[model samples]
Target: MKWFEGSVADAISSAQQKRCLFIVFAADEQPASVSTQESWDSDAVGSVASSSVALKVTPGSDSYTQFTQIYPVTIVPTSYMISPLSGGPLEVVQGTASTDELLAKLQSAQEKLTSAGSAMAANTAGAAPAQASAAATAPAPQTASGAAASTTPAAQQPSNEDKIAKARELIAMKRQQRQEEEKQKDLDSELSRRESGKKLQEYKAQQKSREASDRRKEMQREKDEADRAREEIRRKIAEDKAARRQKQSGSAAASASSEPVSATAAAAAAPSVARPPSLPSDMARIQFRFPDGSSLTEDFSSTTQLSVARQFVADRVSDRFPNGFSLCTTYPRQELTFEVDDQTLQELQLSPRSAVLVLPKTTGKQRRGGSGAGAATALSPDSGVWKIIMIPLLLLQAIWQWLTGSAASSSSPSTPAPSGSQAASQPMPQASSSGDAAEARQRRGRGPETGSSFGVSKEGRVNRFKPNDGGDEDDDMGTWNGNSTQQQ
Candidate 1:
């Protein structure tokens, strides 16, 4: 016969109060070689096994005589265990299976009595009664297998209270671990949020700088546009002034062209005005009245006619500007007449056509003054009586030419000259006398005899004058004649 057997001879007691046994029979019981591995973890629960061996039980074997050999008892605690097939922890026997030697003896005796008949062979059949008497007196060895069998029934089952208590303790520990993990996660999330906020602030600052740059560009563009507009207005103003000057020049030229054509058909144009006449010192001091009923009486001793008048108008008008002044006319309209009491003159309003009667402010034989009537009579062939007579004569000749149709025939450059007709018009004796008189005047170094003599030598050139040709005696005689004629 055979029996699986193990003993405490090679067992080690762990700090956890558990036993680690080097198995002697585990491989025989399962028909496979037991693992020899001693799996010692940090927890120190190690397993070991020996090679499979057969357990012998004959009439005189150690297993049959020793009552404690086959049925030795051990203690176990309430704990869960790992199941091989289920691959998880399972419930364990809870209460300690403490074995009392007396109780084990009594228990083993009963089992032996029950199994004595089966154990006896024909040759040992006579020993059955002696085995039965010994079994009744001595107890059996109580091992883990026997103890589990006796207590697992409903009447003798171990309580589950200890198992429940251990399960609750493990659950509490797992919950605390979960809480710690959650706290670490929260810390990580907070760190991420702070970094995001920093980046956002930097982005906003960059955006503001971009906006400011755009505004600067916009302002520069506006300034350029404004400068362009000002330049355009200035150009237009210059163009308008130039156009006015050209128009005035054209009108003056047309008037000169429309004047009478000479009998020789030479172009007869009006002479330009003489340069401002040099008057005596007494005539230089003149005064004028403004249009605002105000009089400006000042010494024009060193002033020109236009300059004196302009100064007076500027001074007078500036005073009235708070009320306002019109600039449409070159000169204002209110006229000024001569000879009034201070009160009346002060109260008078002058018109634009007002004439300053240039009379001698002082009178004596030695006083310096011009003969006004004679001076007026000295007007050039372009003005006064000469102009009046020439215009009528020109009109009559033009009408005569048109009626006779001689203008086309006789006016041509290639036409034969009328010998007597031209000779009668220009007498040789009078022409020769005029030439001799001009030669005498030249030798005396006289000034120009006519206003037409003063002129520029060429276009864009300075004005020049040819000296006069009359003697002083002749000049004085002419002056006497002019004064006597004015008296008549």
Candidate 2:
């Protein structure tokens, strides 16, 4: 068998360079005869080819058997490998390949290739530089460097194990660098985003300050305008009040200068003013004087003027007269005067001893009678004439007794007169002359006598009686004469 040794990359090159068959074998304590051609195809030579290995053992038996399998070899595994060296003396082959083994055959081929690679390297390392260059340029399955680098000695070349370890280490270092670059890019992007947010906050704060300043200015402007308007209104109100006060003061001053006195004062001065002169051509002048020194003269008829004068006097006297005072007038001439009680008093306010009531004769019997008659009548009693004479006669007799020397006895006391009416008629001349006279006086004194005295007159006035003219004395003398003649 031709010798060759290398990894899968070298193996394909050697298979072409040496044109040798790569035989495989199993490894065991007792190798068995196994066939490799039946187990592995000739095309199985690449990476991962060393994963197949064969072991020889009988099914259900504790005994070993000949390995029979074929497999491609790339990298060796740590598991058991079986041998196919069985038959006759049970030969223990170490690297020979056989049937009935899979991974064992590929592993035996790898061992042989490895041994050959060691010998080739030894031969090249001991050579002169010229020979080393020729040998290195020669077709070798185990070398990775190009022909120009092959002049280097075998001792200077990297071991297959060492090359693989360094390749793995380089790949891991590249991956670690890529991960660190990615992490740096992520951290930079995060920092940039935070800076952008801080700038946005500053911008918003400045905008708010601008808006607040504008609003405050607007509010202040409105307040100033309102204050101006209020001041204008106050000025107008003050002007109006001053104008009204001036107008009222002017009017009050004008009123004081125009009028001299009050209406009551003017009326009181009327009585002192001179009367207008009367026209002589006018008929029947009437004139009067008022207490206030004012005089009035009316050119009207006397009767009409008298009527007006009477009404004026009644009005003047109404305030002074009391209820009991009466008026009596004994009118004997022209012009009228008022009388109170018995006499004609000039004023009702003062009492006078006597005065005459004079009324115009043209006022006729009507004034002498009518409502004026009461003013002329005297207030007296209602007793008849007979009692009038007898009552005074009895009072005289009583006085005569006291005037005489004898003291009057109580039994012979004089009796009082009867009032206005006599008793019912009876026989006359029953007593003697003196006794009759005494009895007659007693009857008259018993009660009130009736005459005009203290009685109301026919004119509805208070009339007092007066002494008779002559009729009563004649009647009494006739009665006395007839009695004396009858006694003779």
Candidate 3:
């Protein structure tokens, strides 16, 4: 489509002179307009439109204004085909069209233009005779009346130039409206984007704060648990210490109760001994544990003689151990006998807070008794001595009873009487047998009735003795007895 570079009126005059169809293309910068232009420029459509006079008109141009007066373009990319003879549109293609469609439209417009030209020629030849005949029979016209004839004919209908101006105004108004709409749409899009971004930032901040709060709560919970664990440990430690202290106090009280009153009174009445001038004035506190699980505490000057300490203990336990007891220390175990008695407590390092043990002295007689025949004689009924004596005696008694089963019955008065001498001799044997039976009964009675001699009897006379280095010893100094010395 080679568009003629001329004004709309000139293009129409040229089409009339050439006796061809006048083509007008109206378009804008819109994409549909460009597509339509391309279609028309193609070889197929261009070849078909080549014989016609083609004019291209865009918006806001003089040619567009001139063309839109007769054909107001409501949509862009419109094509108009005007007849050269009639100067009226023959075909109109609105919006974009394909190459084939454009070709068909051009062909149709050309046929219409050719038909219009033929009609005009036929009408011209026929109209010449009609005019001659009318001239031959018609009368001359009368002149118009004075002023009415002079007045201008009634105002003619609006011309093409007026229509073109109105179309231009409309196009301008629509273009302004489209510009305003695009501006408003852009503003709306920007505002929405900003609002969304703000919401996202706020959500992120809230999530971060929530996470931090959760972390803090977890830390606090862990700390609380740790504190509880530590408190439980501390409570357990305190309870154990209290239990130990109570046990020690109970034991001390039991030991003190078992001590002799006479010895305790004597100890209380004794005067405090003077200490050596070289020693410090601080007193030493000593704890004494007796063999019976009893305990006592005493205070003494550091320089006081060890003999005085020994005397103090001696007086308290004098009745229980007439031979006296010995004292010893446990840490660096050493006996505190008469040999160390003359030494000052400080010299023996028995100062500050020290613990001593009271062990009963072992006498020569007690040791001898523990190791010798006296020990065997003093044994309980469960001892080997009692087992040896009782088992055989029991067996002998059973045998004797079996053998004498019918002797007494057979010796009845039924037999004839013996001589007087024989009878006197039989009486001596009977007396000896009766005496032996009495001795055996006495021995059986002396033995413990129950299995264990040390066990308590109905009389509550069971004696409990401690084991010594020499083995077992009697609590009494005189003789063995199955009774406590205290009970005796």
Candidate 4:
């Protein structure tokens, strides 16, 4: 069977599923000249992984971290056999062993487990019969409540036999009963001792188990600290490497830019026949294609500086692309690294027939503080953010419109029209709706009666008097206009 290759946890799960021990450890370093993978691939050791799961571990890898902590592995190629049931180490097999011996060891462990289980089961079965038989043969015990008790009359029993003979008999019986009581006490004491011893053993077992768990946890904590240290080291190394690469790129760019007419021009203009045969010199021509499909060709010395090539290509399309550009190869295109900028055209190793496409320079600015806001461009005012910003203004505008509409409706006047010639003397036929007349009366309560702005109340009270309509004008009020006002 093929062994499943994964982390320590996966190995444990597989072991539990298969009901087998999980073996976890790293293999010894093989000699550089060694031809075979002897530990896992060889036929001799194949069966070892077939039976129990094998987990491979690296010193710094997270895989099998718990295994390394729980089992001390001072030597390489050490193996730990862990029980699937308790998830604890069952045995540690050190060094290498022959295939037969390894198989024998595994077989022996299996047999021992099987035999122990059988022996326990047999002992339990045997004990059950014995207990049942003893219970069946033993008489029922008389408890204090079930026993028949009798009282001596007048608290005295003196004359049943001759006094001396009865007394002697009673004394002998008392001595025998006392001896039996002593024997029963000795038996009870022995039982108590055995029980106490058993309890002590159980407590010791629990204490040991607790101590083992504590040790495991401590080991795991140490391993975690070590892993974090290793991670920090790796991060530092990576940072150092990146810094070196950046430094190299900077130095090269500085030197290449200082060259007046870089070596590329000489290599390109020099005739190939004049070059030495051993140098494998060739005149390579490159065409830089733009996004618009219009391309420009530049004949450069295969040893040309990237900056020279960049300047040449930029000159051809300088009108349209004044901002500068980057050159990349096509067919699984990749932008050329600046590290290659200072290198000769020969170092770049472009095939004589290959072409480079000119790409626009990336328009990204360095942020000062490295904040997200600085790194990211603020969205355009016409973007979705602007739409969200306009929501509140739209709501406020709508609210203002509603408020003005409500004020306009409430402040509007609803005065009644004058009925036929109230100005001329006839009190025209009773008037329109009483509702309008009632509303006019309510309006009069707020302001004084005036001539230009006037109304008729429900009581036929006119706000203004027509001077010639048979009515008298009181200071800011009206007179009765229909009948007796003129006569008075």
Could you give candidate 3's per-residue lDDT for residues 1-488 as a string of tens digits?
Answer: 78999898899889979999888889888999889999989998888888889999999998899887756776688888877765556777888988888889988888887887788689767866765675556555456533433332222334677756765665565556645755786799799999999999999999999999999999999999999999999999999999988997897687678755686675675445423334345778788899888888888998889989888888788887766688989989988878887898788888867899988878999878778866756454545565554554445544554444233222211223333333322322232374465354323222222233332112223333322233445543233244423543
Q: TM-score of model 3 relative to the true fold? A: 0.29
Which ten residues in a row are the worst by lDDT in model 2?
82-91
Sorted by lDDT, highest first, which candidate order results? 3, 4, 2, 1
Write model 1 residue lDDT over 1-488, tens digit each, in one string.
Answer: 12235322212112013311111111112111212111111112211112112232223344334522422212111222221111122222222222232124323433443243245344255555655575556555479755654443433322466545654565455345545655776788788888899989999999999999999999999999999999999999999999987987897788578875674334223333422345454343334434545544443333233433444555655654444322222245432322231222112322222234222123433333456645655654434565544554555544543433232223212222223324223322222354554453333222223443331121122122322343243222222121123211
Question: Quick one: best lDDT, which candidate?
Answer: 3
**TM-score for each model:** 0.26, 0.21, 0.29, 0.23
The clash count for each model shown is 16, 77, 0, 6
Ranking by TM-score: 3, 1, 4, 2
1-488 per-residue lDDT for model 4 (tens digits): 25557767777788878877576656545541122125445565665557777676755566646666645555466556565644444444555644565556656655544564477578667866765675566566576422322222222334535555754565456446545756797899899999999999999999999999999999999999999999999999999999988997897697568755657786675567657664235655678888998887766777677778877866677887666677798976878867678976666766355689887764445233444563343343434564455555545544543543343344323333322223122222333464553454344431222332443322344333334333444523554443436322
Write down the lDDT that model 3 would get. 0.70
Clashes of 2: 77
Name the weakest run of 10 consecutive residues (lDDT summed) in model 4.
419-428
Model 4 segments more than 4 A misplaced: 32-40, 86-90, 116-488
